[model samples]
Target: MNEGDERALKVAVLGCGAVGSQVVRLLTEQRDDLAARVGAPVELVGVAVRRLDAPREVDVPAGLLTTDATELVSRGDVDVVVEVIGGIEPARSLILAALDNGASVVTANKALLAEDGPTLFEAAAKAERDLYYEAAVAGAIPILRPLRESLAGDRVTRVLGIVNGTTNFILDRMDTSGAGFSEALEEAQELGYAEADPTADVEGFDAAAKAAILASLAFHSRVTASDVHREGISEVTAADVASARDMGSVVKLLAICELRPGPDGQDQVAARVHPAMIPRSHPLASVHEAYNAVFVESEAAGQLMFYGPGAGGAPTASAVLGDLVTVARNRLDGTRGAGESAYADRAVQPMGETRTRYHVAIDVDDRAGVLAAVANAFADHDVSIQTVRQEGRGADAQLVVVSHSAPDSALSATVEQLREMDIVREVTSVMRVEGDAE
Candidate 1:
């Protein structure tokens, strides 16, 4: 240490798992480079863990590992805390303590943020400290920073993305190899693309959390995970993939957030995560395997895409390190960086009220009046048909109807009415369509 230089910024790590291990490694390996970038030396003081003897992907120095995370955050001397311990409870409590104790925080906890971000943001603002989570949404793709900083001045209309790598990997396999959902999921698990319990990713909870964060950032509103309408890829069958193929598109689980006009002539926000069919030519359609991509639309920037590896140890760790540098630099400068922006406070419109398009496949009797009854049902519900194609043998025919954009309530009602009618045999599949003209 030089006598003439200011004291180095002390930082701490919470959790030494996959991403955390990589973070520790980078802090040790790239100490000088990070110090140069932040205009001050960034030192790792401690790593909080559940068990000291638990096997780790990377080795932790003997003196740094501790089981009590609460003590580390409230130590009064730490300048920044990097949290990779996901979930609520300890993570949230520790973060609040760190901020209240005058320490900046950089985390990758999407669940805590999506469920309760305003509280944390308010706490950080009260303490005049920065809380940055660049790794929360899309791994190393740099989506949140661009949305929060670069497009801060501009109005963002929409954000459509493939945010979950596990779902994307499963869907990509189903689309390419014509595999069933079970078959594709097994392959994903064997290839380490999915966890032993992949419920969060497959059931759309993970993406829904990310979508909530994206919506909150893009629209400047407070959107929670409950506000998002979620649908898993578990129900996405092989027939759905074939149906998408017939339309020159591919099936993908999408996290979509849009700034839409409300009935009162005010702009409202709608966020959702579901399996959708997007055109093959779309930028996100090409994001195959365990990769992530976000497509942003703004008034000034027009269109922009951020793509990269969405998860795993190294890619996610790199994002955590980037945030650590930014926060550390802000600490040295005696200035605070930007926090959450919920000034607009726009309404998060319900899924039933949101306007969307759908591709409906129906199996009906080949007899006369079947097509007429279906068309009349849609007309009764005020849903206009964009295209209609039918194929099958006598007494076992099918009709594929793609409808123009309409309120979800009306379209759903139309499908329900069709289900009750004698002429309609069964509603085989009803999937949303995105990345196309409405």
Candidate 2:
């Protein structure tokens, strides 16, 4: 074995489930190549695991597995710590310890970042170490780097993405197979697209976390998971999917982040995750299965689309490795890569102030005056109706209305007013419309 001119950089990977095992393989198998890229051979110092005897996808080298995560980060010899642990407490404490101990940290923990990213960034900054999390959102799409670096000069106006693979798979199943929500979810669980306890994915918590991250990067704001207005796809019915199809659209769960001027003239961020209808011809509507795609709109870049495999052990590991190499190179060069750039620090706008179009389906009396009354209801709320499609007649009649872009509050108020109308029997569905020009 030839000793490279540059000293080897020791890497500690915390957690050894699916992604961890792959990280170990890449670090070992690609050592020579990675060494060339980083100008230093990157060695896997140890892997922190709960159980040393658990089965793994890749073989761990001798004497590399340990149960002491705290001690691993605090070893004081590690140069880069890669954290794949997904939660808040232990992951947060370990990452803080790693940065505090003079080690650059690379993490794919979206939850920790979205919940308390600024704290981690501050710690890394105080320690003058690099912190990169390209794998936290959109898996291997490389969206974060583009937002945080490539488009750093440009003003990013919006980031619309299908960030969650589980919901995307279920929605794609509902559209393609004409299956209902429950049946589609069951199939997703069976196929490993969704987990047995999939509340995080299906209920929009996962997408919201990703949304917070995207909003922060795209708008240079401090957006957290709690700041996001979340509406899950659990309320997405088969009828909603059918309605989308009828309008030459498709139903998909979307994480939308926008930067618009606030009342006092400073740019504000509006971040939300929900099920929305997108036109079939749109780029995002075509993203199917468990794949993820982010459509970024910026002033200088115009329009850019990032599409690829979003999740699974391998693809996500690929993103983790990308960050690892960059951080490793920085480590070897005695310099540091970019940390969080929340320098802009724009305000996060509430959901009611966000402007968007809406698709509303109402069951109303088929008799005269109902249509006029509903139109009046929309007008009263300052909501402009874009298109109206009527179905059946009399008691079984349905009035499908798509509204022009308006303040979300106005749309909600209009729906509430419609619900109180004597002629309106039921509000079958009310969904935000996206990916189509009004």
TM-score of 1: 0.98
Our tally of clashes for model 2 stands at 0
Provide the RMSD of all predictions against the true structure, rounded to 1 decimal: 1.5, 1.8
- Candidate 1 runs further than 4 Å off: 1-4
lDDT scores for all predictions? Answer: 0.93, 0.92
TM-score of each: 0.98, 0.98
Worst 10 residues of 1 by lDDT: 1-10
**lDDT, residue 288, candidate 2:** 93
- Model 2 worst lDDT run, 10 consecutive residues: 1-10
